[model samples]
Target: MMLIDTSVLISMFRDQTGRVAERLSALVGDGDLYLTRFTQMELLQGCRDEAEWLRLDSYLEGQTYIEATDLTWAEAARIYFDLRRKGLRVRSVIDCYIAQLALENQMTLIHNDRDFEVIAKLRRYRQTTLDTVRSTDFHENDQDAIL
Candidate 1:
């Protein structure tokens, strides 16, 4: 299974040509999709108005969202401190939580955010860029030029 991050979901929602979303859709189509609570919260927070929030709520009704437990928090704390000691300043607590979720679950993360790339390189978690996934398809050669 793979863990998806909020950045990829937001990009997908805002751009139809977004490779992240396309890959996510492909994963879902293949029955290999999973989501963390952190991702769900981030996506919900992007709703600007009540109507949008309701729409998002309705859309997420059947989705499964996983939460980071106490063990995950301990792992996140360790990761946070380690990254800090290495002079890497993660921008948000959410990023740590997202990374922790992927790490603790032993899942590969699919994200477009550079933050994930940094975390993957430092922490040894696996990650793949949307561009790389898109490149697997002949029709997706224009992804980089999309937006």
Candidate 2:
């Protein structure tokens, strides 16, 4: 039903206050939670050690993983071009790819990145607000913050 973005996952694990955990628990009970291969790549790139890698991998293994077909990959580029034509941009191409995945699949994205917000505005897509725990992960500015 929803794709958990890497930014939100980072926040969930780093948040000492437990708010992200509470939200994640609710999502887990609400049908299926999903991850894109792109999100997996981004997350794995952040792991500091084999221990951290295994821990995160073990948790991610429980979620449903989604992949892009050739057509979908091309579609992602179109979305990028659409944004560029409009004089808009997100932080990364992967955000565009991830947005395309969620948009096509009709899955809401649980994210803590403003890139998703920008992508959402380009074409309607379901999104929820979340934060990167404290100040260390994502910017705290109201405009840049995401869910």
RMSD of each: 6.5, 4.8
Candidate 2 lDDT, tens digit per residue, 1-147?
A: 888887777677666778878877776675688888776766666777778788878877877897887878888888888999999987677888888888889988888888888887787888876653333465322122222
Q: Write the per-residue lDDT of candidate 1 for residues 1-147, one digit (tens) a residue.
A: 678766666666666555656667775566556777766666676676778888877777767776778788877777778888899876665677778887877777777666666676678786665755442221211122211
Best by lDDT: 2
Extract clashing residue pairs from model 2: 111-147, 129-147, 130-147
Badly placed stretches (over 4 Å) of model 2 are 132-136, 139-147
Off by over 4 Å in 1: 18-20, 27-29, 131-147
lDDT of residue 104 for candidate 1: 75
Q: Residue 22 CA error for candidate 1 (Å)?
A: 2.7
State TM-scores per candidate: 0.78, 0.84
Candidate 1 positional error at 61, Å? 2.1
